[model samples]
Target: MKRRKVPLRMCISCKEMKPKKELLRIVKNSEGKINIDLNGKLPGRGAYICHNPQCLEKAIKHKLFERIFQQKVDKEIYVRLTDILTENDEDI
Candidate 1:
């Protein structure tokens, strides 16, 4: 039997590749609304971020999401992502 291939995604903040299941997905839809896709099933342009505080900070510092989305990303979005990262960390 062959082993199933793991899907890999790059963390927008750190620019590092990691398994898709290990990262959070943020989506930009047709209406340009951005959302945090917890289940990885949202329909849109999705970007991944690892569960690391440092990565979130770096992305915020350099406005990484803004570059990818081609729009000004709100600070609240980063804050929310930070909260999610911290929550996930606590779970482990």
Candidate 2:
């Protein structure tokens, strides 16, 4: 019998494996655009987090996104990301 390997992703906030798609993807493209990878098809360095404001807030507060992307996240970008997450929460 052979064992199947499960695909796992580390959540930037809780730092646990929940699954790939279960976590929202944050991608930094070659051109240096940081955005949520809703389609999960972008080619770049990626980070994962749960689709919750609290998780996102925790990641932002601890600067985990910067660590994951290896780039300096500007204050304005942080503000926009928070706003985007807030809107997503409302839609959910």
Total backbone collisions for each predicted model = 0, 0
Q: Which is the leading candidate under lDDT?
A: 1
TM-score of each: 0.92, 0.74
User: Mind giving the per-residue lDDT tens digits that candidate 1 earns over 6-39?
Assistant: 9999999888899999998999999998898999
> Compared with the true structure, what per-residue lDDT tens digits does model 2 show for residues 1-92?
99988788988898888878678888898998887777889888888887678888898888899987788877776676677678778987
Model 2 deviation from the true structure expressed as Cα RMSD, one decimal place = 2.9
Distance (Å) between predicted and true CA of 61, model 1? 0.6
Model 1 misplaced regions, further than 4 Å:
none
Ten consecutive residues with minimal summed lDDT in candidate 1? 70-79
Model 2 alpha-carbon drift over 4 Å, by segment:
1-6, 74-92
For candidate 1, the lDDT comes to 0.89
